[model samples]
Target: MLTIWSGLAVGAIYVLVAIGFNIMFVASDTFNFAQPQYLMLGTFVSYTIVVSLGLPLVVALVVGGVVGFAVGVLEDWIAIRPLSGTGVHGELVTTVGWSVIMQGCVLLLWGSAPHRVPGAGSDSVLTLLGGRLSVNDVVLIALAVGLSFGTHYWFTHSKLGIAGLAASEDRQAAMIRGINVNRLSTGACAVAGALLGSLGAVVGPKTFAVFTLGSILVLKAFVALAVGGFGSFKGALIGGFAVGVVEALVGRYLGTEFANLAVFGVLIGVLLLRPQGLFGQRRERVV
Candidate 1:
């Protein structure tokens, strides 16, 4: 049970990261390899506000989100917009370069050491279903579930969200229909950055602020995205939780070293069985 709770907390973070990836991919039809850096920067920003500046958690989150949003917009303008209409490989290389630059900046500013921040919730523990869990864990679980469901509903029902989806499905058609593709793309990046920033504050206590954190997170999040099916919001949530739970179980029973092996083994197996992923739809060739 403790393992389950811990896995859920980690899964929540993965879900947020995956969602950010999905948002960016849908809006721009390109993956932002630098997305994980936003998460890293958000954590450091929150630490600066809440720990160094001695501000309230809410303030830290808000500031972090704003900074993240600005960075996201900057990325779209500098890295994405200029490379638009180019092949995916170019964008991928550009984004990866940007991610490396951000990592360097973080190392220079924050140094090589990891910094810890206060938890989002109290240290108190509660028992549920014979499992003892911390308040922070509960909060993480709640936020993960809530945000996942909320995003799904918003995409399905909200006008702007639906427009974003339409734009993603057919950017040319959306443009002909009077939708501003550029604006949508920028807005999607901003939204993704904000979500990642706020999530950093929420999960800071579990994972310390560190420069190298982004690399690990981005890899895990990508795994979740691939497993859940790219572009499927619900799949991100499901894939994240599945990865987290499986990793936790493997680490507990087998060994820490075997955990990653098992996770990737599962991914390989899944890909072999269903290349499109669990919820991902395979695109059919019109030809």
Candidate 2:
């Protein structure tokens, strides 16, 4: 039971991280490598607001989200937008550079130490269905599942979402149809950043706010994206949950090191078998 609940918690975090990656990458066709940094930034901001400045949790969360949103827009303008071309080379280089800069900034501000988040509702462990789990774990899992659908709806139903979808299919056609590609791209980035930052703010206190947090999370998210589909919402959710469950089960049976290796290997095999991903649309080749 403990294993099951714990596995669910782990899966939730992966889902959150992977969703952000899917949204940002699919909308703009650019890899926002700095996304993890934004997550860490959100965590750090919340830590500063709540722990250091003695602000309320609500306030800290708001500030953290706002900060993350701004960072996302800035990244799109500076690193991603500039590189909008035939391929993602420009965005890739710029994001790598931005990641370095953000890391450096984090180091300068927070140093190399890990910060803790204060307890939310309750830290008490609850037993359910013969399994012990913390309240935070329950909340995190619920949030992840809820947000998965929420984000899917946001992208598919909303006006902005339709515009984003149009842009994703073809930038030229989207533009010709009066879709503002730039705004859609920027909005997508902002949304991704806010979601990631909010996830960090909620999860960071429990996890640690460290320098390598961004890199590690981003790597995990990248794996999820590949496993799911680079641009598929359902793919990210499914891939992330599977990765988490596999990691947990593997770690329990084997060692932690083998878990990552096993998942990556599976990802490679899956991609080889189905390149379009589990639910991804088939890519049409241009002559």
Candidate 3:
């Protein structure tokens, strides 16, 4: 029971990250590898505002989101817009360069040491239906679920959402339809980065949230993306939760170290059987 609940919680986090990837992929048709750096920067920013500057948690959250928004928009302008699906190699290199820059900036600002967020509250465990959990963990899980639903609503119903979808499906058509593809891509990046940043700010203080940790989290998110299918929103959600459950069950019975290996092994198995993913559509290029 504990494993089940806890795994669901972790799965929620992965879902958030995977959706972030999907939003960027769909909007810009490019992978924003610097995304994890945004997460790290957001955490550090939250730490600065909340702990160092003595602001309220609400303020920290807002500030973190804003920082993410700014950075994401900047990256899209300076990096993504220029490349715009020239091919994966150029985008990958650009993203990697941005990642290095962000790492340097973080190191310079925060120094080499890892710092914990102040006042993460008592370690007293909360119980629900015989399942033990931490307050922070519960909050993180709830935020992830809320963001997931919110993203779905925004993408499917809103005006900007439709425009963004159009931009992804056909950039030239979107422009011809007066969709302002550049702005749409930037907006998607901002929203996705803000969500990931906020999630990091909320979760970072409770655990080890150094630069490397942020990088590792993003890698897990990518695995979730691959497992869920690259561009399928539904697949991202399902894959994240599925991976989370598997990890939890493995950790409970086997050990912690093997959890990741097991998750990837399962992902590989799935990909081997279903390359296009459970929800992914096979693309038909119109010549």
Candidate 4:
């Protein structure tokens, strides 16, 4: 039971990362590899505000969000916009390089040590249905799940969402129809940035603020994204929880070393069975 809760907590983080990837992908047909780093930056910023400056956590959230938004704008202007061309997905050279650069900057700014951030609500452990879980775990799980469904609903129902869908499918046609694709793209990045920034409050408590957090979380989130299917919010939820549970169960029964192995094993199995992922659209190319 404890293990399951642990998995859910960790998986919630993955879901957040996957959503960030999805937002960028939907907007620009590109995954900001630096997206994960953006969340990592949030954690450090929150840490600085909460610990170094002795400011309230709320202040940290707002500041981190602004910083993240600014960074997202810069990312679009510098790393993504300049290299716009055909076959860009397989060749996101600048974004990948930017991730490395962000990591280096983080190391220089925060050092290589991990810092603990305080959790909200309560510090006591609560037992639910024979499972022991922390307040932060419950908070993260509930928040991630709600956001996933909320996003799914919004994208499926709202006019703006429908427009985003149209834009994602065919930007040129959408532009011809007056969709303002560039604004959509920037808006997606900005929204994702704000979310990650606010999420740092809970995330820092669970994972600790560290320079390598982005790299680690991004890889696992990619696994979730692959398993759940690209462009599907429900997929992100299911895939994230699934990956987390599998990793936890494996670590508990097998060993810590085999946990990652088991998670990747699931990814391979899913792709082998359904290449487009469980919910992704099927595309056919003509030769």
Index of the highest-lDDT prediction: 4
- Selected candidate, larger TM-score, 2 vs 3: 2
Number of the candidate with higher TM-score, 1 or 2: 1
lDDT of 4 at 210: 93
Which pairs clash in model 3?
none
Residues 1-287, candidate 3, lDDT per residue (tens digit)? 89988887777777777888888876667777777777778778878888789888778778888888988888888877788745444867787788788888888888877878753542657999999877777876776667666776877888887777778887888888888888888888888788777766676755544766557767777877788788777788878888889999999899999998999998889889888776777778889
Off by over 4 Å in 2: 86-88
Clashes of 4: 0
CA lDDT of every candidate: 0.84, 0.79, 0.77, 0.85
lDDT of 4 by residue, 1-287 (tens): 88988898889999988988887776667777888888899999989999999999889888988988888777777777666435455426788888898889999988999999876763778899789888888999998899888888878889888888888777788989988877787777777777887778778988899999998998899999999999888899989999999999999999999999999999999999998888888857478
Model 4 spans with C-alpha error above 4 angstroms: 85-87, 284-287
Instruction: Choose the strongest candidate by TM-score.
Output: 1
**Which is the winner by lDDT between candidate 3 and candidate 4?**
4
lDDT of 3 at 229: 89
Residue-level lDDT tens digits of model 1 in 1-287? 88887777788788888888988876668788889888899889888888999999999788878988998888888888787654454878888988998899999998989999776564788998777877877787788778878887888899888888888777788989999988988998888888888777877777889999889898888998899999888888989898899899999999989988988887898899988888898867476
In angstroms, how far off is 107's CA in candidate 4? 1.3
Model 2 has an lDDT value of 0.79
How well does each candidate superpose onto the true structure, as a TM-score?
0.96, 0.94, 0.91, 0.95
